[model samples]
Target: MDPLLPRPVQDLGHYRLPSWWTPGAPRWRQALWLLVGLPLLASELPGTPWRQWLLRLFGAQIGAGGRLKPRLRVKCPWRLVVGDHCWLGEAVWIDNLASVTLGDRVCISQGAYLCTGNHDVRSPGFELKVAPILIDNDAWIAAQAMLAPGTQVGAGAVVALAAVASGLIEPGVIVAGHPALVVGRR
Candidate 1:
């Protein structure tokens, strides 16, 4: 094997996924969540109440009056926390490898992705890294936007369409563009 050549697929043993973090549910519960809970939650026919009930059953801490639209995908309900009157639009994917918390009246628009897991590119092994995401009260994540690991969307902040948000967003401001920047005040 040449030292300069990139290793074959079988030789790539450097990558390691963390075993300490559980999805906050037992194996059976996780299986049930994917098999039954997801389909029900993704259906419009079940309505908000039924969908909410399914999430609750899977251990999500969803507050009263929250509205999750059809096609919403939550990686782990047990690691999710949604506050009252929050709205999750169609095809919203919360890849909460760590905890994801949404405060009161937070709105995540269609096709938005909230990711709490990333790879450490600086490391040769490309280690998995996990961090929580927090969207404060009245924060709005616009359509197709992405909130990266460890980001905090401040109270009343607005992340504009298709933006990539990372790090902290100041309270009551509008941010846009890739690697989102403050565009204006709310």
Candidate 2:
């Protein structure tokens, strides 16, 4: 093998998912949540109240008066929490393999992706790793932005369009670029 070449996974059987992680509800209940609950929650036909009702019914901790817009995908409703008057815009994907908490008045704009799971590249088995994500009060994640695992966006911060947030964002800052840097203060 060439020294510069990356090592491939030796044993796929050694891969193991985190023991702490579980589908919050029973298999049947989870199935129902995915099949029945998700569609209704993602529909534009149902207003905020109806969408919120569906989310709550599936065990998500959604506060009052938030708008969950059409076509948004939430992997695990039980692992999500959104505070009062938040807005999740169209086609936002919350891949919450771990917990994702959004504070009051947060706005996640169209096509933003919040991901809480990744793989350890150094591990021979390519082991899975997960961490929680937090978007504090009044933070705005603009269109097409991606928030990686363990990221914390501070209060009133803005992640600009198509940016990727892989670390902590200071309060009242505006960030832009692929790795997301502070461009200005809010």
Candidate 2 regions with alpha-carbon error over 4 angstroms: 1-14, 44-46
How far residue 142's Cα lies from its native spot in candidate 2, in Å, is 0.3
lDDT of 1 by residue, 20-56 (tens): 7566778999899889887777766636887888888
- Cα displacement (angstroms), candidate 1, residue 31, comes to 1.0
TM-score of each: 0.90, 0.91
Error of 2 at 48 (Å): 1.7
Candidate 1 residue 72 C-alpha distance from true site, Å: 0.5
Candidate 2 lands at a TM-score of 0.91
In model 1, which range of ten residues has the least summed lDDT?
7-16
